[model samples]
Target: MNKPSSCVRRALSLRPCAFAVLSLAAACAAHAEQPMQPLLLAQNARMPSLQDMVVTATRTEQPLSDLVADISIVDRETIEHSGATGVADLLARLPGVEITRNGGIGNATSMYLRGAETRFTAVYIDGVRVDSQSTGGAQWEQIPLAQIERIEVLRGPAAAVYGSDAIGGVIQLFTRKGEGAAAPYVGVGLGSQGTRKLEAGISGAIGADKALDYSLGLAHARSDGFDTKTSGAHNPDRDGYRSTSGNARLGYQINARHKLDATLLASRMNSGYDAFTYKPASPVDDRNLHRLHTAGLTWAAQWTEAYSTRVSVTDSASCYETTPSLYRTETSLRGYVWQNEYRLGAHRFSAALERREDRLDNPALTASGLAINQGRSQDALALGYGYSAGGHTVQVNLRHDDDSEFGGKGTGSVAYGYAIAPAWRVTASLGTAFRAPTLYQRFSEYGLPTLRPESGRNAELGLRYAEGRSTFSAVVYRNRVSNLIVFSAPGGCPSTFGCYASTARAQYEGLTLAASQQWAGVQWHGSIDIQNPRDLDTGKQLRRRAKHHATFGADTQVAGWTLGAEVQASGRRFENETNTQVLGGYTLVNLYASTRLARDYTLLARIDNLGDKAYELARTYATPGRTFYVGLKWAPQ
Candidate 1:
């Protein structure tokens, strides 16, 4: 999307001042060893050289730079500085990610990755799957950013280890753990459109040796609508939400080779947002309330140096209630997973077995509602061998999965990375993945019942170059889908004409380029993604798929002051499967400034939507305009 005229003028007015400040900061960084000042401990540790290890890629703890996949890590520093209020906003800033929000805040959100459907991406919290089994997708607004410690995004298929709903990729979130000392903090902020927010949290250890860790957070937010209805009156424009979430983790070491960890998490939120359907009267308070609870236990043991096994059990439940009877439902999922790994030098083999039972009870029975109980049992076996010799690393993985609902599926992948020089590297990977049909897609007898699972394959190649303070990476990928599910008019229907289920083949190709540089106390980062996702048979672009998206930002530190600015651009996309309606693109900018007030306290201020441009992310649902907020954080030892 292009920036509006007013936004362009406003940005131009600030360019001269921003350039001057950047120049001065660059000069100072030249004399200092560290360019970007430490605004948060998490941010400081996110540098490639500072991180100790990561385990999200292979289900085994390993060094971050040693993995063969393209992954992105968002630490707490990135989360706090982005001025994002929820998980959806934070994830939308990543490469190859598109988010659709229904309204300004506390609204329904859907996410798509690499041209895949909303349900293709898998979500996990502490290694436990979090998506609803019936819907096969996640509601991003249900999870708040305040409770997350870090998020790791694996940008390709991971069904080899995660089982289902991982055809596009996998996003894993780790909750906060105890740090050095107990800390309590509170924050309050006010912004545009009558927006107001308050949050408080405390995190600490419970034992003498700090073996048990716990965190509790509570947040409340409210906002007024920015649109007026046809009745010449403002719609029930009041959007208010309150959430309480807490996490506890206890780790006990039975022996040097055995360890056990248990985790408990809960979140409850009451939110309101306008519905998308047309109504006769001014619609205000057409909202939904969401409640979620999750708990799990994991045990790890190393029988020998080359053999290890992990067993985990988790349960999660969600309930959604709306003002109207058509929007109420309750879904619950309980599952257990067991995994074993055997390592021998460059060869690692794994086997896993999982069973999940899902129950969807829709009491309202609104057209598409019915009581359904489904049991999905899966078994997976994989073999991966990686060898690094003479600056060249090659890895090959073969995986097979058997699901009760969709039968047996097999996939294979090969990934290779070669260090062309001391400062440059190139990597390439080709893999096959698939997404099984959700219960609602296959067993929703109320509307349609004839549907099949979607299957696809992907290939990606990337390049990375790093020298001193500059690093650049680029990736090009192509994905082809067979038996792609689509909504179309049924043939030879017994009833009236309406939407029905069908299958269509499609192909999607995209390129993503990202670069970040630190020079003279200034760090600049930018990324651009271009995609051509279309149906093979019809040669039509996929609905809600943006053709081009870009993000640019710069972070600077001068003395003890930190300043940052970001601009995000989303291109035009279709609003419906038929491509009958299109939504124009838009560009929005955000600015943040933070300073350390004392040894244990810091203050920050953020300005969002600096141009006050009116834009609609979804059909008839407008996003917020310019907003400003200031917050203070205190940490006591």
Candidate 2:
């Protein structure tokens, strides 16, 4: 008899872990024998109510409890108190999410949603889509976390509502909006490794009727970082980064029926990294320069008591350049969407027409010294229907996209949720999604013109219980992809070394268990993910992804201060797709505290990797150890 493939063995081993987590969740539910009641929160409580509205699930506002999608929300309060280094750093604490950075906060970064490739998950900032046609994903390192006010993570296929590149999930980031009285704030921070930061912002309404509101913010941060490369082959010099970012939001209410809003965010970053061209004797410092811009204009009109319409125009530009190595790429994305929503009793309907254009400019990619510029456009029409009444909820979506390169693609999804009890709910969903190949993958030196788009089919089941300060959720999902793109030996392209091809299939199957409860004056939350992401043809695990990863944390308010501690752990992972290089598993502990220093002054301190554990997110990369930051902010009461 033939031996079982490695992928099969890995999948088999993860079954026990997944079952254990499910059993735990069941046991927790059984323990809740008492009657559940509505949540009543103190003014200082941090636990978010399940009734909070979220938009990323269906591209429309829906109460969290009324939806069937697996999602997570991070508000500005959490962001300000966490003292995270970047957007990816903050999102790494969420369920079914993982991140890897080549070096520091300013270096190359990748975020995986349920073990999917970065490109499979679409990202948006203030409703503006941001992506790189050259790299096939958003530049995670370029996103400014300080300017973001809220984040929504939807962990499932939603191509029917979002168009292409929603195979894994979608992430939406929102900036601050203005309302109420004029408010202003300023902050300064000092941290280990010669880190310093300064930030300021103000928001308020100005008109007599408060019909106009605005917000503006600016931040500057610099860090003298440690050596990023541990390998002796590169230069042994300290790497550092400098960043400047700003954001503005303005809104006008044209009477009671119409409103207009505009948002803009810009950021620039310069960081140092050791390149392959480093020489021991006469090493030259390499610099990575990044500039990012996102802007959007939205108009909403209430046509009737039960109907509304919204139109938005968005544009984003991302540019990356490396000095001394002479590589530069720029991606510009423009989007236009007109969405209509209608509500009648317990039924909701939505229709949207969307258009997206992507342009890629690579001065380095030239045939005869002239720069190469390539672009593509996609036009789509989408429709959605939702019904929620009593204990049953249903949602259906369909979309058809006409691509300039790929002709036509259609996607759809259906989701249903049933309330088994006052505090318990079960959900199931099935969806189809797709992602087009990057322009660089089809036109670069190592490109293949015949490559097809990657398509995915996803199915999931979830059970959730929420009542008062206690919440528990368990989700099981499997996403299978065909025509998976990977670089292979030269044959189809001009490059003799290698070329991209759609020659493989892959599967991402995972069980995610998450829970939160307030017990003994402490608020506790945790999540664990047991997944098997493997290439179907080779039967090997995907690179840089683990089979088991988990996070646990607790927060408590004591003596007018909030204190929190967290632990992050991961199992061993393969450094390469071939599974030849093994990266060891590790654990990290982090602590944070915040308190009001005065009536108008608040202070916060955070310590990450408290034990100075040595771990690697990627091969030959050194992770930060025992980093600390302290900040003080002042705002008028």
Candidate 3:
């Protein structure tokens, strides 16, 4: 009666377009070379300056320059140099990424990629997926940055490659891997606010033929932080935090055709935050506790020179609890994937089968006499094809998921890239994505059984130029979503309170400009984002996301010491969907320096918020002032 609903109308128009795209891709592949060869990274060497290989784009390793999608890579060197206190802090420096925290490190946090909601991004450690079914997103605050070796960020919808929760994008973290002779390192740090840190790690390869490789690490950090709440209604005492984390990775090569790898990581954190109360007589010290564990095992077999197969098993558990307030929630996930790949000349094909199971448990909800222990599973089949020759690169992906609760859903994507001139390229992409309702959203007190999955349609265009040590890129994208889930007045549910509904619609559109250059004995990099993420029904911008943000930095070696400086600026933003409350714009400056202190020792120092400017990441939440940190490390040469 409501004119066939907007979602249904969009779905009806998408079918024919999807069919034509698939047909065109098939025709292109059919005309390419027929002979088969193994997909190898060493074979594609077109861009000599940019040789980094990334795996998050296609679930397979490929040269960065060859990818049609937008991606960013961060290495351990950058991580150590930035001196960031949390994973979200580090990510905010990258293009198209923004973060907000309730107070300080070890607090409730959220990240937005291209103005998408925090729950839209899919996160992984090693090959193991990490998510909170109850919260509907990765708990960014719990992930330890000390144990991470590298990170790959893909900033576009990848639902075709990853079954679900990739409506915004995907982030993959890789821990340290052993390669050379045995090496061990130790580091200690001191900082403002009584901050202290201790870390140690060892990595090496063993066995007669160096067939076995292993890495192990452990770290501990504590800080006596400042008061987080400024309203004077909550706790006025300092909120401190303590954390401990460990990681291990092992790899073995059996002959030249078979290989095995395993990874395990664990972390525990306890932090203080301001809890809400009705004009309490005295301040209350509230504690937030978190525990996380991730494990993965993978095996790869190369049957012939032209074919290979990979099998992986992964599991992860995330738990969150608050003291005094009496709330606890736990989430566990298990996954299995089998992938096969074949390459012939310039054409590559891949097929994979994946299965994922998610479980959520909440004692608080159970106390209310509710059936809160819930779970869901998804089984999917994905197919992909790629063609690269001369100056053209094309990729196509299709996936169908069978969700235990929602039945079936299909997603597809097509991308094309062409070299318009030497050192210049243009790319375009079209894709569809969806995210099912979370267990809590479906079974909580304020939930409805009839809630529908959110669906998205995305289109993007990009232009890039890379030459020698300089690179520049501009990308424009628009993503429209239907059946967006939102909570509103009671409807279709038993509860008299508000319930989750699927009547909202939204869109995320933006332009991202980024560049890197080496000139005058210094390396410079910067990025700017102009985005508009809004609700179509209300014509209001998304909360807590600025329409304009930019970052700039430069590093130079001076007299045997590496010195760097950076600037981060953001425009004003609304604190609520109605756009009535505004958070003022702010700018921050940071500086860092590192140098060899002795034969086997190095010294590093950093200063953040140089001006000690006061700002707020959230309404009524306090931000850090100027902070100082220095560290020393020792390793064998």
Candidate 4:
């Protein structure tokens, strides 16, 4: 089938949403005889206990259950079985997190972690910070899923360990690397909204003794997407998008005591968008191009039986290329960190120092109320301690950061854990965090140059039970933020275009529940979240944050087939701070299937919005409707 070039824009009312659901049903009926594959099972060997190794919560590997923070792991097996098109879709299923996108497929995207501001959360790729400096957030739409091996998410304040922008949490993406033997894979897919994708990759060891290993992947995707806005518009045109990305890695083990590694990733995208208010004479539709690149190098050495050291350097660059008269911007980050670890019996101690520079050039965007040639630098020192003994765990962290733009700030955290039984555990923690003001937030015409960093204090309590085939977890947390930066309305500002100022206090209290169970061949995974995020002064709910969020799903593997179904729901939320505009609550259903076609080959199909529900995470943002997709993958047995 050929790709679509355009779409006719029409109002996405409830009636159309209902009809779209019928269309999805018809498509599924056509494939009723095909049996899907089962859900992905654990691919790694189990440890003696549930609290296994994790790298994000602490710089060192430690048991997740033993750590004071909440963490979730998206393993390779889960990724393959989910059959997700991108990271946003996969992350939305996690507890205490919400994803909001302006449009479907390669559009501006943001994540709200525990109802915190978007800039409070940080994202890393293979330990290198990869977010855009211009926006102070990751370009989630531009991140390629083909190269990702797994994702590790640490919830709650981690500023003491990761520095700025960890007030909400930290997300780290691990790339695929060669392990044992040489292997190659390829895949192709076509889906609704005129989507098509092609991907290929290879990984293996080279030379004698398998001392050198390398992995490389390439991908290209394009979509003739639906209209981004349909409620009321002057120009009704398809907002198409195209992108290409690459990932490459190399590692060399010189000896048992020394090793070196390097990795690089690049992505480029061209996407079309429309103006806030459509107009024919002014040209409401236009396409913009973007480019992102990141590279890293590291060396590790085992100095002694109980000590190890590692040093790394990472650099990343991003560019937004648009009409010179419209807007154009570029950003770069260069960073270096040195870490040392020593272990004494069941106790571990670690220390690290980091330096990073952020630079931005917005020559063409200077007229858009933001300044040009902005730069900032930061230096941090972190120390950590961990001890484990007889069903008891203790962890503590302390860090201080000095910034050229904001002077200095200090943060720290402590947590304790106790195991009543081999499968049951209880934990509690208290932490402090801060978010440095972004360059744009300070240099823009709407900026407050004298702004101070936002600060946070949080307390968390959690319980977990993990047995043979099932696991359950529940947590309650409260985070208080002070010195919130917000735009002052014209009424309180010196001019009509109001300036930004730190004026409000905010608090977020929430409860989260998550569980996974497998009986026979059937597997179930689900989560529920309840939160009350309010502006303390006005006592009103925060914008774009739902008070209630929940997800339920089940998948099974039978024979060579796998089948899965999912449902997601969100409560009503306000569109702005004043709470006048309301976006109603909504629910969505999705279905997926995969089956082995032959040796080393498989077929996959999925339907999103099985009910063709009409809903919005943000007002006026058109989301994907009843959608269909099919693909074929090939790999060695």
Q: Say which candidate scores most in lDDT.
A: 2
Instruction: Name the lDDT value of residue 373 in candidate 3.
Output: 84
What local lDDT score does residue 79 receive in model 2, on the 0 to 100 scale?
85
Which tens-of-lDDT digit does each residue in 463-543 have in candidate 3? 876655556677999988899889899877756878899899999999887765555777666777788999999999999
What number of clashing residue pairs does each candidate have, in the order they appear? 1, 0, 1, 9
Predicted candidate 2 versus true structure: per-residue lDDT over 191-221, tens digit per residue: 9999999999999998869999999999999
Pitting candidate 3 against candidate 4, the one with the higher lDDT is 3
Model 1 Cα lDDT, one tens digit per residue, 448-565:
4545667778889987655455555678998888887665664533334443365698887887766566656677666667788888988878877788876667778868989888
lDDT of each: 0.67, 0.85, 0.82, 0.77
- Per-model TM-score on C-alpha atoms: 0.87, 0.94, 0.91, 0.90
lDDT of 4 by residue, 1-637 (tens): 1111221111101112334223322322232233322222221111113546788998766766557667777776566656566787787877788888877666777888898877788888887886666677777876877678878878898998989888889988888888779889998999888899899999999877888999998988888988877576544688878888889999999999999999898877788776555466676556666777778999989999999988999988777664322566677888899998999997889899999898777663443454468899999999999887888889899999999988889999998999988767899999999988777667755566787898999999988766655566778999999988777764433346887677779998998766655555676666677889999999999998988887767778777788888877788888898999998888888888889999999898888789998888778878878989898989887
The best candidate by TM-score is 2
* TM value for model 4: 0.90
Q: Tell me the spans in candidate 3 whose CA falls farther than 4 Å from its real position.
A: 1-49, 365-371
Candidate 2: TM-score?
0.94
Look at candidate 2 and tell me the lDDT of residue 385: 95
Ranking by lDDT: 2, 3, 4, 1
